[model samples]
Target: MVELLAGLSENCVRLLDVAAAGVLLSDGRGVLRLVAASSERTRLLELFQLQRDEGPCLDCFRTGTPVLVPELAATADRWPAFCAAADGVGFRSVHAVPMRLQTTVLGTLGLFGSQVGSLDRSDLDLGQALAHVASVAVVNERAAADSATVNAQLQHALTSRVVLEQAKGVIAHVGDLTVEDAFRVMRRYARDHGRRLGEVAGDVVERRLAGRDLLEHARSVDLLPEE
Candidate 1:
């Protein structure tokens, strides 16, 4: 991810002839955070964007679309804070490209130009291509992470199931009850105590919870008939 950000910043400088480049990514909480920049000045400016909450990057991220400002002076009324701050830092123009997948925007890539003029069609196309590639990488990475989490949860559920079955057998032998009754008692105890069934079952199997306790809880809850 770090390498990707660095490449993005460098490519923007080379291909767009911008004075500096920076990337800002959403924190998944509707706030843009600077992740990378081609130079120290650009990094500082990007950080300022977060503090002020007004910049081409923020606008692009919010709209899930590009924001091209050919002249900073021309946008001073629209983005006063951003334009003033950017002008103070020696930038005359800025362009922002959204890193997006379909309608979802993940971030923005910002370009700072020393002179004011719009990017040619070729430059705009290249900028979009870069943003597209970055978006795909981010989406794929997130999908892989989600898949791993699902796999881990499935494995834990399987282990819990095995432990629950063993607990049912133990309770049946200890309480002189059928396996079905034992399982019912365990489930009732867990529900009454606001604990996970797997946790209650593990305790029963380890003898941490006595068989008498399980029977008492079941009777208290009217989940099992008296023998």
Candidate 2:
């Protein structure tokens, strides 16, 4: 996701005719965590805004709207610290577009400029379009990660179930007992030994020493209730 955003930031500088560009994204909980910057100065300016917690991007995220500052000088009264920081970094103007997925605002896409002028209608529209693309990219990346985690968990469950079934069949045949009784005996032994039933069943299928001892113990302990 960072690599894609870095490329998109470069596109902003090239196509939007902006001096520099940076992308800032929140962690879905109103906290900015990721940044894709076109230059070192641009990176510092982004960090400055995050540290002070006051800037065009912050406003854009809060309202789920675009914040365009054509001339940073004119916004001194509104964002005094932000204006000063922009000047320090040699940026004269800035613009912010909301990075949103549906009605949920994720963060902001920031554009920095060396000159003091607003982006025209076409450029402004393009900027917003880029922001939309970035929003979708971030959300989809997160969704893919969550999906992988769920898949791994489901696969583990299926494998364990199969192992347990095989172990039950082995123990039932060895002990001359019903499959259900074999399972109950294994469950009791596992609980007494502070182990999982599947793990104990695995030992039985593998014919390990632990499996031999468990069978002997189960027989002595009574494999089933007497009528």
RMSD of each: 21.2, 21.6
TM-score of every prediction relative to native: 0.62, 0.61
Off by over 4 Å in 1: 141-227
**Cα lDDT of model 1 by residue, 30-124, tens digit:** 45667667766787788888898888889898888899999999989888988888898899999899987665667799989999999888988
Residues 59-99 of candidate 2 have per-residue lDDT tens digits of 98889999999999998998899899999989998989988
* Count of residue pairs whose backbone atoms collide, per candidate: 0, 0
- Evaluate model 1: give its lDDT: 0.77
lDDT (C-alpha, whole model) for all candidates = 0.77, 0.75
Cα lDDT for residue 23, model 1? 78
lDDT of candidate 2 at residue 128, scale 0 to 100: 97
Off by over 4 Å in 2: 141-227
- Worst ten-residue run, lDDT, model 1? 149-158
Ten residues in a row with the worst lDDT in model 2? 149-158
**Candidate 2 residue-pair clash tally:** 0
